[model samples]
Target: MSINIDIRLKKACKIFREGENISGLILLQTNSDVKHDGIFLTMEGAVNLQLSSKTVGIFEAFYNSVKPIQLVQYTVEVVPAGKIPSGKTEIPFELPLKPRGNKSLYETYHGVFVNIQYMLRCDIKRSFLAKGVSKSLEFIVEDRRPVKKTDREQSKAVSFRIKPESLQNTRDKSNVPRFCISGKIDSLSCRLSDPLIGEVVIESCETVIKSVELQLVRVETCGCAEGYSRDATEIQNIQVGEGNVCTGLAIPIYMVFPRLFTCPTLSTSNFKVEFEVNLIVVFEDDYLVTENFPIILTRH
Candidate 1:
């Protein structure tokens, strides 16, 4: 006979805070009566790190540095060895969200080189002659506390003017197209719950403006005392202007931080997660001018 298994969370969104309990149910459906050894449920959270291609060979000797760190793990038997009738059966379960030993629960983040994840797994043990069935479900974890008022009050807005002369890494200044752009970010320190707010204006340009885009980037660092691997990757890109024709027109800047892909600015002994924003202006000839801003993210 065949058995179908599914896992559902109490919260439709499957999001939990640091100290909240993870409550869910397991649904089992079978065409006929089935016998099982037992039903087991396990909750696990971990932080996985990997070295970039450029740093992989360098850390080959210290492979453990990139090993996954277990933050939490709990397993319990939900049902004793018994027989279940045909049709559907629901088994409820609740697991406390607590860190193991001295480890602390960090916000769930999905990045290129670093990832924090929490999963719930259910296993149905069967006889030696029969195959066992299992299922896994993922959930999100967020910080319990918000950013302090002091930190928010201290946040300062930053203004900048981007011109050919202001651009960096240009081998020849004369070759760069003449352009003038100005913008002001409301604040360099931003809350994870709110959208990033800013405004930009195109003052003048010698060449036709092709596109204006805002790129959110994530900087992940992982390593130990011997060495460290740091990499920056783009998380999302939003186009604010396309085929720009008018000059001196203000363009609003707004971007929502995507969950699971971003977390509060974090720095630990083993790893660090930071963020940055790049304002890019592309010309008709494909030449682009970029201005970068390092931003601090908070839980508030």
Candidate 2:
């Protein structure tokens, strides 16, 4: 009996993400068409690091060191029946990862490595004599390690600052406010400590509202003149003034609401007119990167 063969591996090298399946193909061939008994494959893992050090005086300062890690093994096998013609084919297999050593150097890192050495054992029986053929394949497995502690610790401790130094509100003498609402953010901090801007805004309609005293009330519950309202509201005192407006007040704002008078509702025309202001603020940190916002209102 005569046995001729051709053997090749899909790749002499392979790579995998831990926990993912490691797979590849094995190619086998026969010459002049021969009957084959079966096919089987197996793999093993090994890790090694070689280091060199210095020598001092007459004695060797340090010796060349070699570290050999543990080995893990895996195996797969498949058999083809009856006589087969000479050709080539693939045998696919998988590799499942089990956790390695627990120490830092023992632990896997971005470049941690594993070497896979494999063997394909073929046992063929023909006529009165039996013969076996085995082949070898070598592969490399690399670890794509996750981020470590040092990187996370470096991202905390944020700082902030406000620009321009002054916050201003400019308004006109109309029923609505007459001014520009502007301010700058210099410093703001959060638990993560990343310097940032939290919340900055001009209350606009809700920012600052002035109240006038109600002189009297009308029977028509919804449209009475300034003097015709259910509430008697008046603001006659201002402790601090800024740019034609009061910055601080001692007057109890609740005392100026429609509730105090319990009279008819004021004219809807007053409510129909909306207040306008330019809301301007810059949100930034010590680094100077920022988001600039603008607030504008147009009356048609």
Every model's TM-score: 0.95, 0.32
TM-score of 1: 0.95
lDDT of 1 by residue, 192-238 (tens): 89999999999999989999999999999999888888899999999
Model 1, position 97: C-alpha lDDT score: 88
Writing each residue's lDDT as its tens digit, candidate 2 over 1-300 gives 344333343444443334655455555566556665656555544434222122122222112222344454555555554565566554555555443454111111111111122223334444345566565554433434443444344334322232223222323323332323323322211111122222222223223433211121112111113321122122122221122233222211111112111211111321111111111222222111122221111100
Overlapping backbone residue pairs in candidate 2 total: 21
Off by over 4 Å in 2: 1-13, 33-38, 49-67, 80-85, 99-134, 151-300
Instruction: Please report, in order, the local distance difference test score of every candidate based on alpha carbons.
Output: 0.90, 0.31
> Model 2: how large is the Cα RMSD against the reference?
29.4
At residue 249, candidate 2 shows an lDDT of 23
Candidate 2 lDDT trough over 10 residues, lowest sum: 270-279
